[model samples]
Target chain A: MPEGPTLAQLGEGELIRRLGAFAPPGQFDDDAALLGAALLGGRPAGDPPLVLNTDVLVEDVHFSAATMGAADVGWRAAAANLSDLAAMGCRGAVGLTVALVAPGHTPWAWVEGAYAGMAELLGSHGGVLLGGDCSGGRQRLLAVTALGRLPAGGGPIRRGDGRPGDVLVSTGAHGISRLGLAVLRGEALPDLPAAGRERAIRAHRRPVPRFDAVAALGASRPAALDWRVAGCDSSDGLATAASCLAVASRCTALLSRSDLPLAAELAGQAQAEDWCLWGGEDFELVLALEPAWAEALVEQLEGARWIGRLVEPQPWGPLGWTEGGGPIASPTAAFRHFG
Target chain B: MPEGPTLAQLGEGELIRRLGAFAPPGQFDDDAALLGAALLGGRPAGDPPLVLNTDVLVEDVHFSAATMGAADVGWRAAAANLSDLAAMGCRGAVGLTVALVAPGHTPWAWVEGAYAGMAELLGSHGGVLLGGDCSGGRQRLLAVTALGRLPAGGGPIRRGDGRPGDVLVSTGAHGISRLGLAVLRGEALPDLPAAGRERAIRAHRRPVPRFDAVAALGASRPAALDWRVAGCDSSDGLATAASCLAVASRCTALLSRSDLPLAAELAGQAQAEDWCLWGGEDFELVLALEPAWAEALVEQLEGARWIGRLVEPQPWGPLGWTEGGGPIASPTAAFRHFG
Candidate 1:
């Protein structure tokens, strides 16, 4: 054994917090780092800011051969990073690079399938595969770095931009991906129909990055607000996303349980509400927008739901219930890597 | 066992070649991918192209606890990616993101030390840590994505840009890192003095990215020749670098054995020349430039040496020897992943 506390003792969140000290302060506060003229220094004024997001998926940690095929594994890895770019308000990605590590005994066909899957996704979206590196290792791992450009003349929508009166909206339903994972694992879900089960499995296997939501948000932005929307993806669950927004913006997020956008397939399921609040890898955009803009967006955009609102900061933590009017306990910790 | 062909059967190069089909043509030919207005569709004319490189370092495969501690592993991982950026002729990096994977039992102190090493290198060079991801894995791994920008009005120094008459120059000596690795492995070398052993050990542990050579090359470029220098870092040894340049440029590289820039530390060592030609992890640059400019740079840049020249393509392969004027056998393949 080594001399100090192991990563399991600290957990992923704490480990990330500790590691954040090595980077520029506040650079890790958002889904992606924005490299703008201000950051690069001496760039021309009209050039759009570049958004970068890196996500790593490891075998047995993020995927399993038992549940996900090589293609699905590749799709999820790319989606995770592209979702981060979307969360940072990029309309589309410029390109992505993949750093892959696999054991020597791994199939070349598997590697080709993964790249094909990534190509399929990028073809549907608007980016190309740039380049990457490969190495042999004990376990299969994929680290994807996605590069995107913010819309011309548009500022990045940051987590810290939420205001007390901003309305919280979810771009689409949650719990579907969790249901999909359960289905793939052969779990019994009595309330879910066969079609619903298939949808859930597909959702888990190939979660879309919600660029449509980003477009809707951009299109619905009131001129006065000037691209000040605040948002993040619900990859770590709704509660965590809300908490992050609230904490970063120094306000309290008041969510209405009745307004939670649980997937139709999960209706009346025993763990539906729980999954809606805490299920990971949903890949939906959770946004805090001006009240009027949120109303317009929800009415105009399919599946958009007004789920919550931001309130004045309280002495307690950043999460609260709109109905009970007090702080809500944090959701059960999500699936942390080392926990 | 799982497929028709395992990665080991095809080797890293063939695997990469197959993977290359999924990317845009010619994107993977260089040390780094250059994303410019042409590739990205509609960037402003004045904006410089962005250069991106991703490098992955796996424990046991890329580093071992026997030879490298946590800090050295991190330093080498970061250096490898930064060297790619330097090879692309970037004066410095914009920033880099690290995707780290380690076991749950990994010491938190080890993780901290690794990040510290990366910070130290980035501090000495010119980039900041933008952001990164962390996960639990069976083996420790680091995937770093480095971002840089081509100089305003300057083109990327591509491997394919060598001209027939260009003289090949090496920025500094090679083989020190290979010697260092041997020393760390407890190999006996009577010819190497204690000082040489210490230097070799240091070289292996913390090889610097030759951004200084990049700067010198930039400064010594003749206005008539523009920025048309063809180069790559000697991370995979001099022979591999020269071969890559020659093959990519469709010319034959005629190297003079008498002019090889072997490290002074290995002056009388029996394997000195072999190490200089075939040893990996030497981060010095191998560049092909116009003869006049090469001579100017060799004089202006300390430790620089004119090692060879590019010649007309032959019916044989791209390598040749100046002494005999016939094809030179390809140096034994360097350390390749999955080989």
Candidate 2:
């Protein structure tokens, strides 16, 4: 019999870790992080341009057909693809997806049903299906290859570029998806109010990308602090996202416990505050700005709020938590899949 | 535990008919040398463009660790991707691949080894690794998407363009892959003794595309026949390929049995002609050309021979024949999956 939490019970980290085993020649690209490792060796002695990222979603494991329909899968699939695009701070995607399914399982009706969900997202995002081949039976896997047009100025916004004193900023709050997962898990409402939990659920199920924030970053063209700054989508909560960006930028970001966005519903899951810090799938943009850009940064965003600042590199903890062991610049609640 | 006949027994017709559950939206371009339906949608509007195709090979079913070594699987995977590009008449692929696998099951060494195979193929074909993703997994899934630069006046070569007098030609012989499959099935090679059979085995294991044929077709540009002539790759076999092209073009094909290309070894497992006729995975381009260009094509191809012709519409059958008793222009065989 299937044991131990039926994938639904496992945290995202553990799940990803387990899935990592099957990955062939994998790196940070699948996680929406930049490819800092030199992709080219000694062909002509030129730096490699364009950060290539890819992600794949599976059925039953990622989403239950019993819970979300094919349309939801389709929509999520596009969202997932777009998240990779946003993670790199690039324009729209020239994406292609490979779908494998059981014969009768993927009848045209089901595929069309799935397309309807994808169309809902694509109608707004503007990427049409290039082409796909359908093969029968093999755990339906959707592999989306998104070709992102890198910015003309430099390249993809990477994490290791951040420096100390950089003000940490996130486009949105965290724990919505975690809360949503909790709600779907049939957990009883906690002491916190139900409204926030509902919002969390909505955010998780129908997450949106921070295209606007990325666009703003691109338009600002702040190359000076840009090298000292870093960015990546907070798909795996603020903390993981922040840590990833910090690693790429080679700096540590301190997140103030108070700043970690925590909705009351988080209490229903594990640690409400922790989930906000570490819980993932928010799809928000976590940015580290120079302290001097703090005021202007806040003004630039329609509703941007200051979070924290980059500090000397710390070996112990990740990006979202501070030195005192509380939430800081990144999400506190971490996601785990395996152990 | 595994039951049923080999994939060759299933045939290509049934496989496609099964996939018909998903109705593909398409353009009305046809050159009826019946084969699997060529999709016209996905690209720009009204640009009869050659298609770009790709596929993902996952561990377990597509190729298992027990039978295929990692490098073999890797080589086969690239071959599969190249097969699609070849089918589309593209020079080669210009993209990357995303491979997901279980971390413990697949070590860094294993992945690097597999990549060795990919690098080998790409080097030969001059394809750069555009980008790719790797993830830990319970099973290994390799998803590859390739980009192709189509010729100015080439795209989806209509299958319906063949006229009654148009002669049929293939880049090379078909059914080699099927014969190869027989060898893979542990059949002794001491069956029938034909030179073509050995070649067929190689075709199945490591098939190569015929760019020479493509160049010839383009350079010759035969226009003797009234109808618009077209060309497509025979993935399943000349039979099924001809069927789809015919259906799309709304025409009939009279395949010549005498022109069938088969290798020497037939007595071992299955009949050579039977296997070749209905065999799948022959990545050979089957061209429907005008009679006037026949000699020139032969001259261009040197030894390439004309095998059949286009005919008026009729049902496929007559056993070792097409359905209508229309005098057997030739006894072309049929390849159907699940028949």
Candidate maximizing DockQ: 1
Whole-model lDDT per candidate = 0.88, 0.57
Residue-wise C-alpha lDDT for candidate 2, range B204-319, written one tens digit per residue:
65666555566566666555433244666676566666666556556666666666655434444546665655676777776667777765776777446676666666665321
lDDT of 2: 0.57
- The true-versus-predicted C-alpha distance at residue B148 of model 2, in Å, is 2.3
- Considering only chain B, report the TM-score of each candidate against the true chain B: 0.96, 0.73
DockQ of each: 0.84, 0.16
- Lowest summed lDDT over 10 consecutive residues: which window, candidate 2 chain A? A39-48
Candidate 1 scores a C-alpha RMSD against the true structure in Å of 1.6
- Which residue ranges in model 1 land beyond 4 Å of their true spot? A330-333, B330-333
Give the TM-scores of the predictions, in the order they appear: 0.98, 0.75
lDDT of 1: 0.88
Output the lDDT of residue A176, model 1: 91
> For model 1, what is the alpha-carbon lDDT of residue A207?
85
